[model samples]
Structures are given as C-alpha cells and as structure tokens.
Target chain A: MQVATFLAYLVAAVLFITGIRRLRKPGTARSGNTIAAFGMVIALVATFLVVEVDAAWVWLLIGVGILLGGVLGAASAQMVPMTAMPQMVAAFNGVGGGCIALVALSEFYQGAAETWVAVISGLLTVVIGSVSFAGSIVAFTKLQELAFTGSVVFPLQQVLNALIFVGILLLSANVLADGAIVEAVGAPFLSPLVSLYILFAASLVLGVLFVIPIGGADMPIVISLLNAFTGLAAAASGFVLGNYALLIGGTLVGASGTILTRLMSGALGRPLGKIIFAGITATATQKGDQQEDREVHDASPGEVGEYLSEEANKIVIVPGYGLAVAQAQGPMHDLMETLESRGKEVLFGIHPVAGRMPGHMNVLLTEAGVPYDKLYDLEDINPEFDDTDAAIIVGANDVVNPAANDPEQDTPISGMPILEVEKAKRVIFVKRSLSPGFAGVDNPLFYDTEKTMMLFSDAKQGLQEVVEAVKSA
Target chain B: MEQLLVQLAIFIIAAFLGFELISRVPNLLHTPLMSATNAIHGIVLVGAIIVFATADDTFTIVVGFIAIVLGAMNVIGGFWVTNRMLGMFRPPVKRVRKRKG
Candidate 1:
C-alpha cells in the first residue's frame, strides 16, 4: 500500500511537469491545463484513499467541502468576464494562501510536528502563507477598484511595516522557545499556542502593509511575487508532512512565479526592489495636475474616420486597460474589419505591459476574434510606425507617451520603452480626457496639434462611431 | 534527518526544472501560464487532507475543513479560468478570408 501511494505521487508530479512544459506554446496550453488537472485528480484521490480516518463525520465534512468549493469555483470561472480576470486570479490565489495558513495552524494545534525541522517549517509556513493571503486580498480589491487604486502611504509607513515584521520574528522565536521548554519538562506552563496566534496576526498585518503602498500600475508584479510566496509556503507545509507531491508541485510554481515577477518588472523598466520598497510617490500625480490648463487638439470620431478612409493606407491600433474598461474590444474589432474591407492594412502594436497584466491585451484582442497574424510585439512593430499613415491609440497613454524618451525628465516611466506612434504621418487618440495613465504622468503626445487628433469619448462609442463613418466614406 | 536530505534534493532539482521550463515561454501566453501555475500549487489540498483525517480536536478539524475547501476552490478555479482564457485565442475564422477574397 505504501509503495502504491508513493508511485501514484511520482506519476502525478510527472504529469504536472509535463503540463507546464506543454504550456510554453499557444497550441498546447489548453491541453496542458487539462493534463495538469488530471494529475490533480490523481493526487486528490490517492490522498482520500490513503489517509486513515477514524471519524465517520470527517468523511462527510470532506465530501461537502469539495462539493461546495467545486460548484462555487466552476461557476465563477465560467461566468467572469475576461476584463475582470486580474481580480479573479487574485481572489483565487488569496484563497489558496488562506488554505496553506490554515493547514499550518491545524498542524500546530494537533502537535503534529514532532521534530525541530517540522516545527521550524510549520512556523515559516504560517507566516508566509498568511502574508500571501492578506496581500492577495488587497491586490484583489485594488484591481477591482473596491478600494483606492493609488499607492496608499501614511507617514512613517515603511517604519511601521518594519516594526511589525520584527514583531512577527520575535513572536515566532518565543513560540519555538516555548516548544523547547515543553519538550524538556513534559508539562506546558506558558503555552506556545498563544505566541503562535500572535505571530499569525502580526504576519497578516505585515502582508496588508506590504501591499497597500503599491500603486495599481504595479499590480502584475505584486501578484506574481505573492504567488511565489504562496508556493514557498506550500513547500514549507510539505516539509511538515513529508509529502513529496506537495514539495515538488509547490517548488515548481515558486520558481516559475519568481522568474515571471522578474520579467514583468524588467519589462516596465523598474527594479523589483524599487517597486516593493520605494513606491511611486505622489509627485507623478502632482505633475499631471500642473498641465491641466494646457490646450490640446480635439476632433470628432467622424473626422478621424474620414482621415482613415481617405488618406491612411496603413494603420496601427494601440490598446490599453481603458479599452478593456469601456468594453470596446468588439467595437474595436468592427473598426479593424471596416478598415480591412476598404483595402487598408491594419495591425496591432502590443506593448508588453499594455494592459493590467502581462499579455492582457493579446488575450482581449484575441477574444474579439482578431487574427493571430495581426498582432505585433513592441520590438516587432516599433519600426513599422515610422512610415505608417496613422497610429490610432484606443484608450492608451503611457505606452505612447514621448516623455519616456526624454532624458531630461525623471518621471516614474522614464527610460521605459514606448511605441513610436509620434513618428507616424498622423496620430489619433480616442480618449475621454487629457488625463494621465496609471503611472500618473501626463502624456505630451496629446498636445501635438499638427501631428495628433484627439477624439474625446468612451472607447466603445468612439470606435463604433468610427466604424459607421468609415463604412459611409 | 536522512529523509530531510532527500526531500531537499528533490526540491532543489524541481525548482531548477521549473525555471528552465518557464524561461522559454513567449510574451503572448504569460497570463495563462501564471494562472496554470497558480492551479498547480493547489496541491496543498493533499496536506489539508492529512491534517483533517488525523484531527482529534474540534479546533483542528474545523481549521482543516476550511483549508480543504479553500484548496479545492483554488485548484478548480485556477485551472478553469486558465482554460477559459486559452479558449479565447482561436484563430480568426475563415469568414474574414472569404469576405476579403
């Protein structure tokens, strides 16, 4: 029986690794997810059969838990709109972190960790897991706009976080010392349980403090980092239980997440430490307000459509989170089709960090039935804009902002790579206002009257009107 | 102590494998890749089951039960959402071609 259980775990780990390997390409990604879920089914069933249960009610409780969780998770996953994916992913990650924390707590309550290694691992799991849990919940709220999406920094915020972190460390040490005392004397005088709960509470607070100061623009990196933390916490729990499947599976995700976090921050031209420690300050917001009075060129969607149909032969569309917010993907697709039908060549210049998450714009465009061949990456499309007829920016600002290239300006997005949309024959922006993007830096591209035209409207209505005008012209 | 050494070796090797596997992925599939990995870590449900099965006290049992539920949700939701996202990446239908021709 023991041999069979270990064999099953070995097989499950192989399947998971295979699935992740297959996920490298678009063609195999769906099958990869299915393969990984199949591995999970095997691991779950083996767990149910191998675990020795003494209470009949425990079986009933476990059954009910799986059923309820399955129904809720499936319904939400099936129904959530693609635009809300970041928050949905955050919520799911939060619950996973919560589960690891609870497992560590239950292990502590049952006195299941008999060795020093298990004790240390259990403590580490509780701290990391709770931090991930609370931090992910904060991330969910920020992405959902349920709370203030800007960086929230009180006076001495960093100092307060440091103090809470130190407190958690000291409380964890006290628990370890209490456990030692209990082992030596065989009697519990000062219980470790009290110190353990205190450690958990402090870690939760530390998690909240860690995430609250990060602005909405940096959510992708933050979520990736927390996902890594949860993975490490699960591995720690595996040490407590001597479970090979948990150890292998959790470490795989931890490594993958760490790499992704690095890649995301690198794409934004920000160091991971800078994003985490010195949050983008209030200076960027103040800078945007200083330019509020500057007059800029504005045009109607009809004029822009006329320009596209009459003058532009080649067009490039740049999309951002606002396009998703306005639910304009369908309309944007319609406009693309209209241009194509009129014998205009249209392509998409997709920035790496164009939307709320990595590859977010690609998924949204693809969902609107855009062909795979129409989308081009920043490196692939930047040179194309130089001789292009028009660069129509749909609800995007930062990626097209020229300030990123100016060495004299030291803004939050300085030195970041941006689309060279300004170099096109004509620039058109479909935006509601001259407001800054998530990084809070006002774009100078909107003010270039000779080369740019701004149509101030919601992205959906703006794109729909453009489509109608193009059809008529 | 011996078991600890073996587990540590496995952990190190798996971490390296993960890094190598994910490093090659292109920018287009990143969100789904993240979501898929998020689901893979849901194997924490195994640990939750062990805790729940052995609990002799009400507090431990209650905590274990919640852990199991949350872990199940994480596993189910992570994979399901990933599948949904990947399902959106279908090639533009043949109608666009027919219309153009």
Candidate 2:
C-alpha cells in the first residue's frame, strides 16, 4: 500500500510537469491537460488507499462534488462571453480557496483538538482560504463589469490594514509559543482558538486591502497572484494532511501560478508592487480628449474592401474582444488566407490584454490555425504599423486609443502602453457599435479623417463579408 | 477488491468531469481554477501538521514536519514567482525624440 501510494504520487507529479510544459505552447495544451488529469486520477486512487473512510459516504461525496462542479462550470462556460473571462477566473479562484478551507476544517475535526500544530495549520488554511475566496470574488465582479473596479479608499486605510496585519502576526506568535507550553501542561484548546480567530480576522482584512488598491488593468496579475496563493495554501494543507501527492501537486500549482503572475506583470510593464498599490482607475479618457473632427472617413463596406484590395501592400490585422464576441476566428483566418494568396503581406498584432483575458486573442487565433510566426507581440509589431499600408483594427478599442499618447488626458489609462494604430497610413475599424471599452470612454481614433474607416458590423459577419468580397473581387 | 474498483471508478468519473469542465472554460478561468485547487491542498497541509504534532510515534512526527516545511516553501515561493511575472506588463516610458538643431 505504501509503495502504491508513492508510485501514484510520482505519476501525478510527472503528469503535472508535463501538463505545465505542454501548456506553454498552443499545439499541445489539450494533450497536456489530459495527461495531468490522468495523473490526478492516479493520485486520487492512491489517496483512498492511505485514508480509510466509509466507502459509501466517500463515493457519495465525490459524486456530489463532481456533479455540482460540472453543472456550475458548464453553465458558466456557456453563458459567459469571452470578454468576461477574467471575472470567471476570479470566481473560480474563490471557489478553490473555499474548498481548501473546507478540507482543512474537516481535517481539524478529525484530529486531536488539543494538537497545536493541527490548530495552526487549520488557522492558516482558513485565513488564507477565506481571503483568497473573498478577494477573488471581488476581482471577478470587477472583471465582469458587474461591480465598481476603482479603488475604494478611506483615509488611513493602509495604516489600519497594517495595524491589523501586525496584530494577527503577534497573535500567531503568541499562539505558537503558548501551544508549546500548553501541550506540556496538557491544555491546547485555549491558545489555538484565539489564534484561529485572530488569523481569520487578519486574513479577511488582508484580502480587502490586497484587492482594494488594484484597478481593472492589473486584474490579470491579481488573478495570477491569487492563483499562486491558492496553490501555496493547498501545499500547506497537504502538509497538514500528511499527503505526499497533495504536497507535490500543490507545490507545482503554486510554482506555476507564481511564474504566470510574473509573466503577466511583465506583459503590463509594471512592477508587482506598483500594480498592487497604484490604485489607479481604468477610465477611458486617457487617450487625449476626442478632438472635434466631424471629418471622419465614412467608407462603405464595399469601398473599404476595394481600398483593402488595391492599396494594401502590407496589412496588419489587430483583433480585439469584439472578434471573440462575434465568433469570427474562422472568417478572420479565411480573410488572412485570402490576403496571403493575393501576395499581400499580412500579420497579426496581439496585445497581451487585448481580449477578455490575457493571451485570449492569441488563443482564438491559434485555434483558427494561424501560423505562429505571423503573430507578433506589441513591442515587435508597434514600429511596423507606420510602414504598413493598412491596419485593420477589429473589436479593439482602448488598446488602440490615442489617449494613451496624450499627456493631459488625466485618465487612469494615460501613460499605459497601447498599440500605435493611429500611425498607420490607412486605418480600418470593425466594431458592432460605438460602445466604449472597459474604460467607458469614446475613442477619438474613430473620428480620425486620415484614411480611417469604420466597418460597423458584427466581427464574424464583417470578416465573412470581407472574405466574400475579396473572393468576388 | 470490489471496493477498490468502485473507488477507482468514482475517481475516474470525477476526474473526467473536471477535465470536461476545464476544456470548455476560456483561458482566463484556468488560473482561478488552479487557485481553487491549490486552496483545497491547503486543507491537506493542515491535516498533516495536526497528525505530526499530535502523533505518539516519532517517525510520523518527523515525516510530518518535513512535509510541512516543504509545503510552506511551495506556497511562499509560488506567490513570490507570481509577483515577479506580473511585473512584465508595465507600459514602457516613451522616449522623447530630440530634434537636431
């Protein structure tokens, strides 16, 4: 039995490593997921071998958890638009934290109530889990556009939080010291309860403080950080449970989450500390105020198609959340193919946070089988926009907004990085309506007369029409 | 043997369901799901710590302590790495082009 448990844990660890590796590239991600899942199944089987429980009840619990999780997960996946993916991530993180806390609670109940170590572990689990759960929920709400995402500040907020944090640490220290003495005296309950209560309060406050200062722009990093936190908490719980597989699995998750968070922060060009404390709102006005120019080029779809066919020597396609919303990846791919066949130089410019989630645009494009080489990150592609004959901006708003350039805009997105679509000789925009982006500000780029045309339609439909127009032409 | 088979079946089914759910979700949800799973592992940590601190056997206690340290390291290290990764996306300061007189 011991050997079997070890083997199962080893297998699970291997699978996890492979899954993480596969996740780095688009082509093998699904296979990696399957492999990891298989390993988890092995780990679960191995866990049952060590921990004997009522067979009927364990089965029932597993069934119920699966059924509930499946139903909820499926419903959310189907109902959520691609734009709300960040929010969904937050909600999922919260759920994970809640589950960990619950598991810790159960473990505590099973242990000797007087055991200080168990009590400390339980306290840690509950505090971290609760904060992650609540904080993630807030993040989800913000990303979903269902709640106010701006920083909520009261005077001395930081000071108050600091005090609470210190208090909790002090309480933890006292409990640890007292627990050792109490165990010697055979009186463990008193110290542990006090520690648990203090830890819980401190964690809750910490969660709020952690999230309150983060604006919507930093959500991707926040989600990644929370993910790491949850992984660590899981590893901690694994220690408490004395489960080798859990420890390995949890450690892998925690490590990966941290790596992803760093990658996300790097993508935003912000330090982690600045992101956590900057508290800047994501107002759309960052693009300098919309210059009053009614001289916007009003090209019909047919006219735009003609211009695209005639003058575009090198065309760059910039996709946004609008593309995902319209499910237009297939049509976009077809359009790219048509352009390529016609000897037009075509490539895609991908903003890190272009779509609802980080790398969403890349994922959607990859699914459509766009060549990896054709996709370029912002830094590599920004300079090429100037020389390109035409730049097609699809379903993207704030990323292309000129307000990022205007110093006086005073908007939260001011000084933030953006794609220089305005520099392109000819600019074409595909959008459903003039609805503002996450920053809720109108784009002045839409009104630019310098060869800018708005192809107002659903992204998928718009791309499909363009494909047909190109074919006929 | 029958009980083991039953448990295995249950485990497989649960894992399959989890996989299916994960597949349908957008990329953004992946991190959150991972976070939630990590939290569940925290419970496992608490359990091990309790067993280690209270168990009469010296071997069990020693093993538990080692596991606890490793687990704590994993959590702390993971968060630190995540913080570093998120620093990647800060917008670069635009260089002012100096005009030659």
Give fnat of each prediction, in order. Answer: 0.75, 0.06
**Cand. 2 Cα-lDDT:** 0.62
Cα distance off (Å), candidate 1, residue B28: 2.2
lDDT of 1 by residue, A1-473 (tens): 37777788889999999999888888788899999999999988888878998879989999898888877888899999888898888888888999999999999888887788898999999999999999999999999999957788788776787788777776666677864653455544546887788888988988888898888888888888899888989988988999988898899889988998887787777789988885434333445345766677789878998999999999999998889989899999999999999899999999878888888888999999887568888888999998799999989999989999999887788888898999899999999887788777888888788889999999999999999989988
Interface RMSD of each: 1.1, 13.3
TM-score of predicted structure 1: 0.95
lDDT of each candidate versus the true structure: 0.87, 0.62
DockQ of each: 0.76, 0.06
Residue A228 of model 1, lDDT score: 87
After TM-score superposition, what is the CA distance of residue A349 in candidate 2 from its true location, in Å? 1.2
